[model samples]
Target: MKKEKVVLAYSGGLDTSVILTWLKETYGYDVIAVCVNVGQEDDFEEVKKKALATGAVDAYAVDVVEEFITEYIYPTLKAGAVYEDDYLLGTSFARPLIAKKLVEIAEKEGAVAIAHGATGKGNDQVRFEATIKALNPRLKIIAPWRIWSLKSREDCIDYAQKHNIPITVTKNKIYSRDQNIWHISHEGGNLENPWNEHDESIYMMSVAPQDAPDEPTYIEIEFEKGIPVKINGEKYDPVTMLTILNKIAGENGVGTIDIIENRLVGMKSRGIYETPGGTVLFKAHKALEKLTLDRDTLSFKKIVAEKYAQLVYDGLWYTPLREALSKFVDHTQECVTGKVKMKLYKGNCVAVASVSPYSLYNEEFVTFGEDDVYNQKDAEGFINLFALPLTIRAIMNEKKIKEEKEVI
Candidate 1:
């Protein structure tokens, strides 16, 4: 009889490497490793070889970086959804795509089960499982971290040594890392302490601010419907454009944020993230939105953005409401096409200039001198009507005060 096959979301890292071996030894099942490349710069060939050498019956490396940026990154940025007003949602955004790919492969390969390395306590396990269920619920999920006795990184390392699997992992550098096209996040290690300061060693994607150039670097980013289309007037593919921007932004020490964020699994985790290109794109998109969107739409969109952040962070990307919210966000992006020039210096990405073709800015109406576009006297009736409710409330309050004083 043929053995039941399982599709594992593998990264060629220590955790997934050990899981690949463990699944074979414990379950006596066929473990097929699938590694999705979302532009983390890892050598997929080497990863595939390592997976095959360890225990995987078959290994596949799927390139999904362009799809990831276009489908996942762009929509979130267009909506201006930043988790907790600080997190760029780099890791969060990648989870759905990775999970979706894992499921797609699982179906193609006719696998009975899908497994992952995400721990029970982390947000990613929720994200991976939620996406898989949403996409294809019939497939069984085997989360080893939740059930296995290998409770800590140390145990995993010891298991690797015993299994004679050649790998590179140390106990001292225990900060869990997740890297992709949008950003790289560092957690665990000393970051578990809320009061601890994030050292420069934690940053893997960007240089330290102190090591950045003394002079500021200026760059221009062009957008079409809130999606960044060009850099310095040169158009490129979604992946290449972001790579160029990441290099430029990182050299100037652009994106580095440290925060203690609430995980989806009912725990607060501290992390340091490096999001060079994403920072530039998000800020520029928001600045363009300000100049283009009307007051009401923009204000209401701010409220929507807050909720949108929660939804995405909680692994609800495949839900109906997320699609509904995207429709609304699409309308807001109609006029959010433009170019923004920014100055990057020492971990700061400051917008210096921004303009959109559909911008509501009017020189004549805003002019200090006399202009035909406006009649100064028109403000009198407008103010009176606008203030009517306030005026009535104040009069009623005065009357009530007088009655109280008389009674006293």
Candidate 2:
């Protein structure tokens, strides 16, 4: 009889590699490893070869970088979703796409279940399982960290060593990292302690702020319908555009943040994130929106952005609310087409100037110099109307005070 097959979200890393072997030994199931590429700097051929060598009956390397950029990254960018006002939801958005791919492969391969290496305490367990549940409710989910005896990374290292498993992590240096085209995040090891300063050697896609050059680098980005299309007057594809910006911004020590964040699992964790290109794009997009979007739309979108960030961070990407919010965000971005010049210096990306054809700013009405559209006399009525509630409240309070004095 053929053994039941389990499709694993295998990264060929220490965690998943160990999980692959353990899944076979523990459950007597054939493990099929699936590695989905979202633009991380990894050799897919090597990853596939490693998976097969590590006892996977079959292995797949799925390339979804372009789809990830266009579908996942761009939508989040358009929504302006920033978690807790700082995190750009890089890992948050990527998880759902990865889970979706796993589900697709599992269905095709006739796998009985999908297994993952997400830890029990971390938010990724929820992110991965939630997407799996939402997409295909019938497939069984196996999380090795939640069920296995290995308690910590050290234990995992020991297990890998005992099994003669090919591994990269060791007790001396073990940092759990997640990387993609948008950003890279570092956790575990010294990062677990909030008080400990992150070592600069951990910097992968960016430089330390203090080490940045003294001179500022300026670049202009153009957006069409809230999507970045060109940089410095050169048009490029989404992947190329982001790659170019990452190189420029990373050199300036941009988009590195060491934060102690509240995970969805009801615990706090410290992690360092590098998002050089994403930071520049977000700043440029906001600058363009300021020029094109009206006051009410921008103000309301701020609230929408907060909620959207929360939804994405919580792995609710496949839900109805996320779809509705994306639609609303798309509507708001109809006029969000423009160019923004940014100044990058020592980890700071500031929008120096912005322009849009749909800009609501009227020089004639607000010019400091005398102009035909000048309405200096209109300010009196405008201020009174704007402050009418305050005036009415003051009048009511005065009348009450006078009546009280008379009674006394």
Worst ten-residue run, lDDT, model 1? Answer: 196-205
Task: Please give the TM-score that candidate 1 achieves against the real structure.
Answer: 0.98
Residues 55-168 of candidate 1: C-alpha lDDT, one tens digit per residue: 899999999999999999999999899999899999998999999999999999999999999999999898999999999999999999999999999899999999988778
lDDT of 2 by residue, 1-408 (tens): 999999999998989999999999999999999999998999999999999999999999999988999999999999999999899988999999999999999999999899999999998899999999999999999999988899999999999999999998889899999999999999999887888988999999999989999999999999999999999889999899999999999999999998888899899888899999999999899988888888899999999999999999999999999999999999999999989999999999999999888888788887888898766898999999999999999999999999999999
Q: Give the total clashing residue pairs for model 2.
A: 0
Candidate 2, residue 226: Cα displacement in angstroms equals 0.2
Among the numbered candidates, top lDDT falls to 2
The TM-score values for the models, in the order shown, are 0.98, 0.99
Q: What is the C-alpha RMSD of each candidate to the true structure, in Å?
A: 1.1, 0.9
Candidate 1 local lDDT, residue 299: 97
Most accurate candidate by TM-score: 2
Residue pairs whose backbone atoms clash in candidate 2? none
